[model samples]
Every structure is written in structure tokens, then in C-alpha cells.
Target: MSLELKDVEKKVGIDTHIHSTNLKLEKNTINILLGSTLAGKTTLMQIMAGLDKPTTGEIWFNGENVTGKEVQKRNCSMVYQQFINYPNFTVFENIASPLKITGVKSDEIKERVGKVAELLKLSAMLNKKPDELSGGQQQRTALARALVKDSDLILLDEPLANLDFKLREELREELPKLFEDRDCIVVYATTEPQDALMIGGNTATLLEGKVIQYGKTLDVYNKPENLTSARVFSDPPMNIAEINKNGETFKINNNNVQWKSNLKIKDGKYKIGIRPHNITTYKEGNNSVEINGKVLISELSGSESLIHFTNGKLNWVSLSNGIQSKNIGEETKLYMNIDEFLYFDQNNRLVNHG
Candidate 1:
């Protein structure tokens, strides 16, 4: 009912792919591995599924050590970013292949496949081949195959990465509900911050080969344990600026911009983080700071405006609610609510406001 990785480390010819990762996941929970490319998400998932052996630690499942266990001996399933399906076989056959491999009775195989296909909305398409199915349908077929096995551990390595935006959105919204009643531990890996938020599960933020922070999805997003976790959990990567804090106010380093901080802290240097959505083209709150910037780029994404600009020596991005455009090099002013700023100490640890 539980999977644990204890002091796990994976090194390939001196290049450490997974560094000292220790994590435990319980059944009926979805865990997200949130990181960018080459951030060791895949390598970690491989280790968990027994596809790759950890170089230095033990893997325990249900209190038994299984570090060196062959993947075939474990009851686990993996779905990749690619919609891998047997083109020559029908959707029902593809879903039942795993059970068929274990020599399940014909009646049980039919029942299991039918139930999983129905849950995945593939019942009507059971007679069709993979080549005839839509991209989303093919992916769902692959997922149905995994679910039909009744796996104790499910590892999804960015299963929706290759689908269209609409299909991806649809699947993301349905994923949590699909796992609501399952008794397995689901670990999903993704590079997009938005995907992790919509999944609404526990998350482990990865950077390079190290896990920076792990906690409940919303708790980790709202209160990142450190600056690295905050940046990894943000879509455009959270904006950072160094500042010098005096008794009552903090001044942006190497700039004339200054603002009052009600935080009680020692007089020293620190870094402040600003999420893109906290900045607006107009004043939004009574206590706000104004920053004048030279526009670098303006991206209109549907109903939102993502503006990248430079203030003093630092580059910042502002995400406004509506259609707001500015030409490159044009001077613009954005207002940021003072309370939304995340204060980090010199050591990169987030400082809580008192």
C-alpha cells in the first residue's frame, strides 16, 4: 500500500541523474514530479518502476526491499508521453494485452477490459485500430491498458505532453477524477507548472537531479520552502531581484527603486520574488509599489497579456488580466501589491512575514 525510496541515487558513468532522493507515497494518492527538461523526472520514474536500479539506495514496497527486482516481477504500469499502442490490434485487444500475458481467464479478461475501456470513454471505439483513433483516443487507449492491469504502482511520464492543447486540457481535468477511487499510487511527471496545479496532488519540485521541496500541491505552490522550489513551481519562472533591507524599507540593488516592507527582519541583503500575476498595468490595491520599465516583449495569450520588461538592471514579467499591449522599448509602468512579494534570505530560504 506504500512505496518508499530511501536515500536513492542514480549515477551513469559519473553523471548523477538522481541525487539522494528519499520519498514515500501512499496508496490512492497522486504525486507529481514537477521540473524542466533534463531535470531527472524520467530517471526518477524509471527507478521507481524498477526499470532502472538506483546506484546507492534501497526501494521498499509494503516493507519489502525491491531495489534489485526485475521490472517483470513487479506489478506496476507506466504510460509515456508518446501514445504507444499496437497499431495492428484493436483497442480492446491493446487494453487486454497485459492481462492476456499473465494468462487471465477469457471471462475475466473481457470483464476487466470492458470496465477499463468504459472508464476511459473508449468503449464505443473498442473495435477500431490505433491508426484510426484520434491522438487523445490513442493516449487513452494506452492509459486504459495500464489501468486494466490493476497495477499497484502507476507511473505516468508526461502522458499528455504530445496531445493538442484542447485534448491535453480535457485529459488534465479528467485525470484527478479517474484516480479518485483507485487503490494504486500514481506518480505523474510534467514540466509545465499549470498542469501540476490542475492535477491537484502532492508535488515534488525537482531541479537538475535534486528534489528541492515536496508537499501538498497548493501548500507547496503558495509557500515554497525555498527560492529554487518557487522558481520551479512558477510557469514563467518567478522574477527575482536582489535588495538591501534597512530597518523599515528595502531598496532594489543598483537602482533608485525603493519600497517600504512591513516585514521584521535584520538589516542585510535579501532577494524578493514576484509572481507574474501580482503585477498589473494599473494600481490594484491601496498599498502598492510602482515600477517603470522598458518593454521588452508583449505576448497576447487569449484574454491575458504577458509583458516582459526591464526595470533598472533586472528583467521582470507582468501578467495583466486583459488585453494590454505596448511596443518594444516603450516605457511602461506596472503596479505590484506589496503583500504578494516573497522575501527570501541570503541563503535562499523563504522568510515568513510576521
Candidate 2:
């Protein structure tokens, strides 16, 4: 049930598309492929699923060479963004179609369909046609169909895109449970960072048709390899600002910003990154990078509030819980967590200070 793509390269004539992409996936765990639009998330999944062929590489599954194999020959099922259920078919028939295609007996098909239906909570909608069911239900039916096939690999391409926010949230929590105890590997592709966090397993960050980083979920988030990968998972995105070294201290906006490092710097230029949640606002502080600014906007979301502050040409955001303020036009001072700052050299590469 394990899948591996070794030196997989896909090209389109003179254009070299995916360049030497290598990935190793273990059995029975969710591997989320995260990227923005047109990042080749779908292309990589398609190659592994046998729907598309790699230009100059091989696909190995369970120690067998399955390259150039037809889609049906590969023991993989995919649930795409578009619900591929038949409008004329009932939910039960749609879920049972794969089983029937493989020549499963009528009684066994019913048994497998029933189990999958209950797992997806589509037992009550089995008799309803695809047209009669809601969007979420149709998606569940599509997933149930894949489950009934007992495929060794499951490929999901933004399967929750069509569902409403609440439904998407519920399914996000439920979908992972369906893979438990199964001998299959699930490759879920998503453009949303929240989905990757909620799924919580091995993750690969794909950028421009290449997987730049792949490791445990938290490790990738905590220590992103470069600026591009760092901004991928950040909400408001990492705030990057230029810094100038003044003797041993780094100065930002002509103010000495304290850095928890003793490394010597003959810097031409350096950039510092800080996440929004890592910043805290204070009225007055002794060792803080204080700046005066007017509140641009305050967004309240019941439990927490996100306040955006602007000081001249510089903009920053702060997070607070249960704190209310009306200072859109008033002056305010802000403080940043210097200890949580990340530094990058002129090449835009992370400079680790140990």
C-alpha cells in the first residue's frame, strides 16, 4: 500500500515541467500536499493515480512498477473537486458502482456499500438520486464509492471545495477517521493551510510544480526552509522588514531592535520575519520596538479580535482576546516579540542562529 515516486520528471516538449520530483509515502497515513493554485498538486496526484503518465520517471506501488498503467488497472480511487456521481443513479448505486465493476457478488456489494454508507453518514440518503441530494451528501457519496472499491491508494483533489463552511469543517474532522485501520495510503491535496493543520500528519509543500519541503506538519511550520515556504502557512503571512546592523544591535526604523544572537554581521542587508500572533501590543514598554500609528481597522471574531495598525508607510497586525478598543483615528503604540523573529540573508535564505 506504500507509494513512491523516484526521480519523477514530467515535461511538455521543449518545456520542462516538473523537474526531478521525489516523494516517498508510507502506508496507511494521510500525506497532505499543500500549495497554491497551479502548483502542480493535481498533476502529481494524477501521475501517481495512473491517470497521467510521467514524462521520464517511474511509479512504484507495493514493490511493483506501475508506470504507464491505465487508470482502471491501478488499484487507486480518486475523489475530485467536481462530484463525479451520476445524476440518474441513486446514492446506493453510486457507492456500489465500483464494487459491481470489479464483479463483486450482489450480497457482498450490498454489505460493502452499507458499511461505507454508514461510515460517511449517508445511510439515510442511499435511496435518493444524486440530483435529489445536497452538495455535501453528493461528496460523501463520491467518497463512499471510493471506499467500496477497497483501493490501495486514495487521491483527493480539493474534495471539500463545493461544501459550505460548516459542512467542510465537519467533514474535515470526519474524513481522517475513515482511513484508520485501512491498508491504503491517502494523498489529500489542498490549497488551504488550515486543512493541513486540521489533518495533522506528514505534509509536503509544493511550489511551482516542485516539492520544496516535506516533513512532519509541525516541523515544517516551525522551521520553514525559506521565505516562500514560510509565507505559505502563515495567516496574515509573515511580516518581513529590512534591518540594519548598528554595531552589535540591529536597527529597524532607526530604533535599536534587540536580537537574541551574538553572531557577527557584516551585513549588506537582512530581513526579519514575524508572525502576526507572535506580536503583542503595549501602551508603553522599556525594551520594545515602539512605534506610533493610527488604527486602520479592527476586526472582531467573537472570541478574538485582530487589529491592524498603520504607522506612516509601515503596517502591522496584532492579535488579542476579549479586548475591545475604538481607536481608528487615534495614535497607538505597538510591541513585537523580538525573541520569535526569523532572520534571512540577502539571498532570502533562512539564517539559523544556534
Model 2's TM-score against the true structure: 0.89
Highest-scoring model, TM-score: 1
Tens-digit lDDT track of model 2 for 13-117: 887667789899999889999888888899899899988899988999888889978998878899989888978889999998887888999999899899989
Give, for candidate 2, the lowest lDDT window spanning 10 residues.
Answer: 282-291
Clashing pairs in 2: none
Please state the error at residue 333 of candidate 2 in Å.
2.8
Q: Write the per-residue lDDT of candidate 1 for residues 1-354, one digit (tens) a residue.
A: 999999999999989999999999988899999999999999999999999999999999999999999999999999999999987999999999999999999999999899989999999999999999999999999999989998999999999999999999999999999888989999999999998899988999999999999989998898998999999999776889999999888899999888997788889999999899888898877879989989999999879999999987898899999899899999998998888888999999999642
TM-score for every candidate vs. truth?
A: 0.97, 0.89
Report the lDDT of model 2 for residue 258.
47
